[model samples]
Target: MRDLRIGIIGVGVMGADHAERVVRRISGARLVAVSDPDLPRATTLAESLGSSSAPAAGTGDGDAIRVIEDPLALIGNAEVDAVIIASPGFAHAEQLMACLEHGKPVLCEKPLTMDTESSLRVVEAEHKLGRQLIQVGFMRRFDPEYAALKQLLDSGELGRTLLLHNVHRNKTVPESFRSEMIVRDSLVHEVDVARWLFDDEIARITVRAPKPTGLVADGVLDPQLAVFEMASGAIADVEVFVNFQVGYEVRCEAVAEKGSATIGLGVDVLTRRAGHWGGAVPDDYRARFGTAYDIEVQRWVDATARGEIDGPTAWDGYAAAAVCTAGVQSLQEGRPVEVEMARRSEVLG
Candidate 1:
C-alpha cells in the first residue's frame, strides 16, 4: 500500500498520541502536518516528529513535519491525502464540514460535536455530498471483546438480548472534567457501544446522580447510573464513575432469552502471591483500548486508500450525539429524557 500523507488537527493529549501513532506505530500513513490553537504545542509535536515526519508540500524538508497554524488549511493541503480531526468536541462540526467540502476522508474524534444540531449539520452535509467521508473515533467498536459480544448477539446464539449492564470506571479525571461530562465525555462511549451492539437507537435515558464524589475539586457528578431504553425493547444500564481513584475499567454483561455473555474481565497480566491474587488494571484508556484504537486507525487508513469509508459512520456519530444530549438533559431535568433525532436519509441508512 502507498503511504498516505496525513494532517492532524489539535495537539492535545489524544491528538498528539494519534499523530505519533500514525507516524511511528501504524502503517501506510505519515504525519505531514499538524495544527492546534496553541501554536507552541503544535510546533512542539512537529519538532518531536524527530526525522519520522514527512514535510507538507512546498516545505523545504521532505522528512520534516510542517506546522500548519490553521487547521482548515491543513485539510486542503495538496500533500495531505486525508485529515484527522482531534480538536475539541465543539470544533468538530466545522472541521468535519470542511473535510466534506474538500472531498477528503476524515477520522474525527467522537461526540462528532457536543450538540445534536451541529452534528446533524455534518450528517446532512455528508449526505448532500453523496459519499461517506467521515468516520467517527468510537474505538470500542474495534475492541475484540466488544466485537465478540456484538457478533454473538447478531448470530442469534444469544437468542434476543434483553439487558446490558455496563460499567465505566476511571481512576481519576482532570480538573477540566465537569459534571455534564459524565454523559458527554465518559458515558458517551457506552452510548455508542450500546447502539452498535444492539443495532438500535436509544429511545429514552434516565440519569441518577445521588451525590458528589468530592474526590476532586470539581463538583461533577460521579458514580452515577444511566439507564438506556433501546428502540428494540432492550435495556442497557451504565454505571459511570470517573473518580474511582482505583483503576480504569469497563465491563458489560448481556442477558439474552437463551443465554448470556460478558466481557471486560481485566484482560491483563495477572499476579499470584502468598496472600493476594489479582491482575493489573489499566490506568487509562490508552492502556486498555490501545490495540483497538490501532486496529481502527489501520483499517481506516487501508480502506480510505482503497477509496472506501470504514467503521462508524456520520449517522452513528449523529445518533450518539443525540443520545448524549438527552443524557445530559436527563441529568438536569431529574427525569427520563427522550432522545430526539431527525429522519435518517436513505443514503445514511
Candidate 2:
C-alpha cells in the first residue's frame, strides 16, 4: 500500500513540529504538501524538509513537497491523503467543513473552533456524513504518565476517583494574551482532562482570580482558580497561572476512595548538587509534551490510514468549548455558571 500523503496547514510552531515529525519520525506517512497564510514560511518549511524527506509514494517529480498558498487548495490536492490542521482556532470550523466535504481525515489542534456553536456545527456535519473523520489534538491523552493514570483508574485500582487537582503554570505569555485566553487556551485542557478522567460532563464551573501578578497587564488575570462540579458528583479544581515566571509545569493529582497518584512532577531525573537537589524543568509545552505530540500524530496517521479516527472526536471538542464558554462567563461575572450543552444522543442520534 502507498504511504499516506500528508499535508499540513499553518507552519507555525505546532504545525512545523508536526510536519517535521511526519518527514523524519513517523512511519507510513510522507509530508506531501504544506500551506500557510504566510507563503514564505510555508515555502521555507517545505524546502527544509524536501532534501531530508522522502518523496511521497507516487510523486515521480523530484519535487518532494508542494507549498500551497491556500489551505483549501491544499486540502483538495489529490496528492494529499490526510491533513494536520494547526491553524488558529478561528479557522477550524471552515477548514473542518472542507475536510468533511472532501472525505479527508484531519487531526485538528484545539479550541476546536473558538466557540460552542461552530464546534457543534462541525460535529453535526460529521454526524451527517456517518463517518468519523476529525480528531481533536488533545495530546495529553497520549502521554505515558496520563495513560497510566487513566488505566489505573479504569482498572478499579484507584477505586472511584473523587477529586482531581490540576496545576498549570507557564513562564510567561505575550502581552496580547488577555485574561479570558487563560481560561480558553490554558484552562480548557483541564476541562477536557476532567471530562476524560472522570467520564462525566461538567455540570457547573466557578472562576476566581487571585491578586494580579505585577508581571502581567492590569486587566489580565495572571493566576486564576476554576472549580468544576461534574455530573457524577466528582469535583475537579484547576489552578492556572500563565505568567508564573517559573518553568512550564503541569501537574495533576487524582484523589480516589482508596488512594491518590500524581504526575508531571519532573522528578524523573532528580539531581543532587552541593547540598541542593533538583531536576530539569521544561521550558515550555513543546519541551514537556514533545513525546506526547509525537505519539498523537503517529496514532492519528495510523488510524487515518485504516479509514478510522482513534482519538478525541468532534463531540469532545464541542463539549470542551461548552465548558470553556461557561468558564469565561464565570470569570467575567465572578459567579458559578452552569455548562449548557445538548444531550449527546440528541446530537449524535
lDDT of each: 0.87, 0.90
Q: What does candidate 2's lDDT look like per residue over 217-329, in tens digits? A: 87998799999999989999999999888789999999999999999989889899999999987779999998999899889988988899988889999999999999999
lDDT tens digits, residues 1-349, model 1?
6588889999898998888788767777777899999998888778767454344422223467889888889998888889988898888888898899999999999879989998888888988887789999999999988998898899997688899999999998888888788799899999998998889899999998987786866567777899999998889999999999889999999999998898999846688898998888889999889989889989999899988888999889989989989988899889999999987855366
Off by over 4 Å in 1: 53-62, 346-349
Clashing pairs in 2: none
Residue 279 accuracy (lDDT) in model 2: 90
For every candidate, C-alpha RMSD to the true structure in Å: 2.9, 2.0
Candidate 1's TM-score: 0.94
